[model samples]
Target: MNFSEVNIGLFRLVNDLGKEHEQLNIIFTFLAEYMVFLLAISVICIWFTRNKESRIMIFCATITFTCAFILGKVSGVFHSNYQPFVELSDVNKLIVKEKDNSFPSDHTILFFSYCFSFWLFKRGWWIFWILLALLVGISRIWVGVHYPFDVIAGMILSFAVAINVYIIVPRLNGTKKILNVYEKYEGKLFQPFRKTKGSKTRNY
Candidate 1:
């Protein structure tokens, strides 16, 4: 099958699966909406880690996500793709229909960009982050809003931006200043990772 055919077939399969159970719909919807907040939680937790490396990586991740979002927005202006519900007849849309461009799933880009940042930096919990990102992407598809190629494109963009961010940020002269400021106030937060009994706290 051609790429577009496979994409449509996968969308139909997931849409059909979504109809099989209300519980599954609830689960996937939750993953699609709220799971992106894991990025915020991750950054907050990493801030209190008191590990200089991880703290620096979080700063890089911030830049990565910002750039990824802007890139997605610019792509939307140049390349338009309608939501499946709008383009296709009788789609089983589980989420509220969005009128915005759907060529590169924004939620997928957000989730995968943050997760790919961890992967690029060799940070902790990258595997978990990747799995969560996958779930969120699949949920977007299952909800009948995004095509499979949208998710794939989001991931590809995410990897490119994330890897470059991790690599380029450390080399920038301003990045060292930012990292220094971050480290200066690092342990002022509730650092649960500090040693309590002479043993280093485990990195989450």
Candidate 2:
């Protein structure tokens, strides 16, 4: 009937699954907690590829994440809720989280911000990234660290920010200039490792 009721119902549906299918708790816990490090590693690998397009995509994702993070903080200030485990009885809580404003799940905002930007930039593997973001959001609820509405709010906010960043960031001349300057220094640093023009192959 009310939004709070609906939110709690959805949270129960997902959180209870961990109780019924205890095996899945491991996977959901990983998604909820450790997947962030995977995302970070992926970003670093992409940036080190020395590919211009990939670098630009990473740049856009970073900007989207930063903006969404700021917005999420502001949203938290206005609307806040404790973790579901703290508020509800018999919650299938799988992860430890500090009691604080759990509204607009920070993990959800973080994953959706970067994942959506990756989806927008690299359409070829769009489903993978989007699905990953979705799973992370759901996992937060499944682990009893967030309510459904908290994850949903984060997804909505990050989706909007991702779209705007994708539309606006790449088109700016300043973006190109910054990339160019960084690449210039990068090339200088890696110059010794580069093969010279018309160099003879050295016998191993």
Candidate 3:
């Protein structure tokens, strides 16, 4: 009826994969976390490839990521703690016991945030990231920390944030200053949009 039910069914599907090997399990978790950073970085790079709209979404990611990290550190003390390690047997019943908090999932936030970035940039390219994003979401439950609901919440939150940034932000036109800067470098790399637009490329 609700999101958790769907997550329960979803997580159950891959419950078998958790049985493979300890090494593989760790690999899944590691990859999930790593992929978030990779996609986040890619979003930042996209600023120059497209236009003002593109860069705005990525800039939101940079800000969101920083906010998440800072909040985790602050929240980690009371609502959460340092999870140094996890054992194999505890994989099931991950949500009720081991993981912290139900409202927001850092992994979900991180995963969906990146997913939104790529999806906006190129739908085809976005598909690959989406698959990787789901895999990463499952890995959290597979390793025993996040519930399906937690991931869903995170993903939903991330999706909303990205959408708001990409769509609503532009409506404000307050982003014009930054968009102008990005538009200037529509075809270059590692350079600010402003500088690229200002440079002379050929003889007049």
Candidate 4:
């Protein structure tokens, strides 16, 4: 009927979903927040390890996620459309206004960027990162801060950033550094994966 009525109806629908799938919602939120922590540690780890490929990868992930956060904040400021996920207590609702801008959720960006970065560091971890990111993306919509379209947009942006990093890292001056280190250890580095292992072990 009226706008307020529509809003109330939507809120009730979302709240029902929260009640129905609270466990999934909690899991996604935890995964998203944990990425923030993991990404920070990854930065320190890369800086210490300072391998050629890792340096480039860490630089890309940090820069991309930073840009993503800035973009989300900017969009939140410029766009108009604020919706609340939960029914805040009357006092809290009175004190703070809801945020606007559903496009390109910062949460999604944070998850995907971290996922991509972790994937680069250890390819085996990619599956875990991807699944976690997927759950986080869905949670944004499930909890009602982002529209499904908004989450999709964030995913696209994250994918673009990751792909660009993949393509451009090689062109950087850093690629030489990575290659040089490998070159110096060519016999060991270039050997096939199977042979390189067990070389230190006895035949028996």
User: Which model scores highest in TM-score?
Assistant: 2
Write down the TM-score for model 3: 0.60
Cα lDDT tens digits for candidate 2, 1-204: 998999999999999999899999999999999999998998898899888888888899899889998999998899888999899999998887889889888898888888898888873466887899899999999999999999999999999999999999999999999999999999898776675532445533
Candidate 2, poorest ten consecutive residues by summed lDDT: 195-204
Shift in Å, residue 91, candidate 2:
0.8
Model 4 lDDT per residue over 1-204, tens place: 975466455445544576576666665555534556775675677554746566666667776677666766666566535444343221111112256555567778877876776575553356777887887776665555655555666777777777666667657786677656755686455467647466645564
- Please give the lDDT score at residue 8 for candidate 2: 95
Error of 3 at 29 (Å): 2.8
Ranked by lDDT from best down, the candidates are 2, 1, 4, 3
- Tens-digit lDDT track for model 1 on 120-158? 787888898889899999999888899888888888888
- The alpha-carbon deviation from the true structure for residue 158 of candidate 1, after best TM-score superposition, in angstroms, is 0.6
lDDT of 4: 0.61
Root-mean-square deviation per candidate: 5.5, 2.2, 6.8, 8.2
| Predictions in order: lDDT | 0.82, 0.89, 0.60, 0.61
Model 3 lDDT at residue 81: 29
* Best of the two (1, 3) by TM-score: 1
TM-scores of the candidates in the order shown: 0.83, 0.93, 0.60, 0.59
Candidate 3 structure quality by residue, lDDT tens digits, 4-49: 4665566555655667655576677676556667765676567546
Model 4 spans with C-alpha error above 4 angstroms: 1-16, 23-25, 32-35, 67-80, 84-98, 117-124, 174-204
